[model samples]
Target: MVSLIIFSILSLDTILNVPELKNAHYGICFLDLKNDSIIYDYNSEKLFVPASNMKIITTAASFYFLGKEFRYKTNFYLRGTIKDRKLYGDIILQGGGDPYFNLENLERFADKIISMGINEITGGLLIIDDYFTDERLPAGWSWHYLDAKYAPEISALSFNKNVVSVRMRPTNAGELANVYIYPSTGYVKLINRMTTTTNSENIIIYRKPEENTIIVDGMINIKNARDIDVAVKDPAMFAGEYLKERLNARNIKVSNPVARIRTYELFLRQKQPVLIDSVLSPNLLEIIKETNTESENLYAEILLKTLGAYRYKEGSFNAGLNAVKEFLNICRVDTQNISLWDGSGLSKHNLISPAVLIAVLKFIYNSNLYYDFYNSLPQPGKGTLKARFNGFSDTLRAKTGALQASSCLSGYIKINGQDYAFSMLFNNFVCPIKKIMQIQERIIRAFYEEMRRTNVDNTELLKPVEVIQQ
Candidate 1:
């Protein structure tokens, strides 16, 4: 049995010792959850960039700290009394850090306003977005990727995930492509320089820094229509503009433009605001599922800030980091082995060892929310794990992370009815991402085969024989 275990460890080593990964910094840890023992480990103590795999940590901590039934509430308040279908005071929209707030919700708010017998407002729409600090971007984020949909600015008042979809359809060859923006608002200006080509499509969309002008350049094949999601500059302002538009569409006239005020300013008013209605976001479990399975950077960041706001009455990144560290301490994970700069792994500064990830997984597994956390991860043929672990769909579940020169996969794998937690962290690799994924798949397959070959009587063989690397 001991020799068989040794052979399995040697086999994994052989699989990892490939030329493509020769220059890469990588770590692996596989633990038998039933036995509470490390089955195999190589460089598991060394820290490496985790990319979106950091969502795993953020989601787990959120599930533990914020109950599964937690929901964000965005409130609507009326500052003055209504008379003859006219509201003399402002209608305040108090943001509650709802990351999933969207245009549909805006419509609902409009309907609520109409139901309140208020058809006209004498004052402007006041937006209270001070639930979170004004730090829109997280620390250590790559500035060059700010225009991307995945790197949108964070805000307490977010609408449509703080992004807009630019759709381009090819026209006659050599002609510029037809451009359209979703929601069709006048909030952004589009500069289209994209031409229709006879060859493959190559489209580049960029939003000017601190501005709403988007430049759409490159070429699109005549047969393809491309839809690119670009991040917005000021998310609160974007939401405000759309809300104002929606109100006008509903025939609710506003005397002034939409205005923003801090929470303190709202409280300083002589006449207190009257709560009219509120919109509630989906429960936290649903949000966590989306955050982990979709690898949503915005949702993770919002969850982080929410923790800070809930625990310390502050919603800054520093407060969020402190909250995450406190949660890690609660899980008994060693703080020295981890460096987390942001909740989303979009920041390149995040570093964690495979052993630390395994520790987090183990802690969640033993907790009451284990099943909730487990089901939140992506599985084979689903979410980020789509097209992965082809033959083990029912037995394998994981989260994948990828960035320039970094790739990682971590989660649970069941073999012969026994569950195991595993993490594979690879960073600074010069090889193509496809090559790294292939290596990871091969290693997982090798371990699966080895574990399947062992019988119930040989279950002890799955226990730790030795640590392959310190």
Candidate 2:
């Protein structure tokens, strides 16, 4: 009995004295599912800016509402008649905002079109992108992001998420040459004379597009640039132009020059979307893994917008937010203190508390999707958290959130061989970000050390004791 009493006192002290956690503007909470325990909690209920941790809530709602098996589809339909392999009318390409559409897929589509045997078209190409209810971009999305490839505007009739790729290569003796686009689309015409000096970081920039112009600026290492193809702006136009070029290569001729044509009708000659090839993405389970482990902005955006498109009966950002709200209400998550403006948590207005986050995790754990949900998080000391707790065991699995003045870590931890769910968030800290990171690391390490000294047998009595009375 004496040992029990002493251990209890020590555990309580350790819980309250978590390093760098005291009086923090942020909040931290720990819940042990195995024993129904709240091992340690400080300001767990206090509201704080959660940053990308916001992805946790958005992703959970998305998984619940969007279903795991859902795959976005882009369709090609023709309105006019096809006579003797010749399209007498216009061909229509309808978009369903497939975020994963790529050049390869587009080319396969073109190949299918070529296989149809119609070499000439009397009418032009028409595109319909009105799948979503709204055309205005997400509120508070930075203008700078408009031009950046990752934050490409959400479009229902999206092709390659409305992005293109331009590459540069260096040849022998300090001269640079034009690089080839994988699915060469003439939507963008390159006039780059920029050269890269040896032993220097390559510079590349995207110029603002003119009324039908996509410009690329900057220099790239000829060798390194050849490795990976980055996303470009205006993927639809690029894709359309590329298809035109490939058709021309096959002796197919278009009556009109390639241009952006926004029409709901498709030329009858190209009504059939012949399936030339198909590329399946990593499953929803795998996608969530990439988002959590790599904190990929692109994936998060895709999933969020995907959620919006699925819910609210429309595939727009507002629709997605409506779906999120409905899912939270259904799950009984407390949203009084939560506010979100974007799915990626890139917006500063997004805010959440440690308690709310833990609540979300707990709710998901108890839900029917528990298995797929749990596996989506990074393995402790492995994926995102690999470098986090250096000295601690590889038992911490959590989502990390980072911004200029904000840092957050929330998820589950297995302390002293005992499993626990936890959340630690810091925001508006005046201290240097380096120091805050140091504090964050120390706090995680302390949880393990404290758990090691406590008795797993008496975890019940110690559960509620961790949450201090406000």
Candidate 3:
């Protein structure tokens, strides 16, 4: 059986020794976990930005420290008195930076208040959103992305990701863009007055903000469209405005007023806080699923915050990094080459070598979360990797990373019923987009095909080739 396996390995190596692929400006490493062996490697020690693939590390660290049952809690407190089933004092909403807060959840939370038989509030309504302290957004994130849906800055009191979808439709006369907010609240202030052209009216332009203002710079191509979607600057403010209207509509009258304040002063309110209700987020497991499956930046950022708050006992980025570094040390992995700015690899300064990633992958594979970690990756023909592997998604499983001039794939591959952990990263490749993707596909296919054939010598297949001086 051993001889046959060796022969099979050798044959596979000979097949994979191709000029086009071998000479490509890329780095890769394939490890046979079943036997604790290196199947193949080429420049795998070179460091490169992992892009969204960095989510894997963040997710793993989260799962390790936070546990799967963890849930972010948003609490409502009452610091005043309720007279005649009315809040005679102040109503406080304390938010701890739950990134998953949404309109539905906020509405449901408000509905719970209605269920409490409180029809009128004689005191003021105050919201506290100072949960997270990090002011630095991810590094290298495009300034234009602030207007895009996914790149909004992380906030402590975020509501609907501080995003509001505005539907912009062209007028019947074909000259005006009619903007409509989906949950149409009267609070949001539109900064740009968009004029719609007949040809550009139908396009749906997504806008997010880097600061307090979100501007819609793109055109929606749809004509006679009654609405379009755009992200707002402050979710808490929008939620507050919408909630006020909602309460008013439900016949809940308020005499004190509405505002946002720090939670530390809850003691100073006329009425001390009474725990009205609590809302729980999806379990940590599902959040991890979202993180790995969709590479959700919101989820990734929240994980980092959670790490800072819980693991290191410090509510800051430095604390988060300290926690991550300590965790890496425990895993016996080197931390010298990595400089992490954010849990999401959205930061350009984020760095790690293919070898370090492989080591991390192997550690996770050998740890208690072996199967769970592997299962979280997008299958080739499905999830995010659906278009990857030339549509042969079933036979491959790898974490893919992509940034301008930097494309990468790293994870476990199940080729011909045998599993192999691999990391393939291409950085600084001055190739065109199509050619880059093609090169990636060819490399993946070549590795898959080579692993299936026999006579492959794992060590020999990965031997570094000789370099000639210029």
Residues 50-79 of candidate 3 have per-residue lDDT tens digits of 787778778778778888888887887766
Q: TM-scores of the models, in the given order?
A: 0.94, 0.79, 0.85
Q: What's the C-alpha lDDT at position 194 in model 2? A: 53
Cα shift from native, residue 77, model 2 (Å): 2.6
Q: What shift in Å separates residue 205 of candidate 2 from its native position after superposition?
A: 1.6
Evaluate candidate 3 by giving its C-alpha RMSD to the native, one decimal: 4.9
lDDT of 2 at 158: 55
For lDDT, candidate 1 versus 2, the one ahead is 1
Model 3: how far residue 370 lies from native, Å = 1.6
State the TM-score for model 2.
0.79
Q: Write the per-residue lDDT of candidate 2 for residues 45-89, one digit (tens) a residue.
A: 777878788778777886787667666667665445668888776
Error of 1 at 143 (Å): 0.7
Question: What stretches of model 3 exceed 4 Å from their correct place?
Answer: 1-25, 134-136, 200-214, 217-231, 255-258, 268-270, 390-392, 455-470
Alpha carbon deviation, residue 321, candidate 2 (Å): 1.1
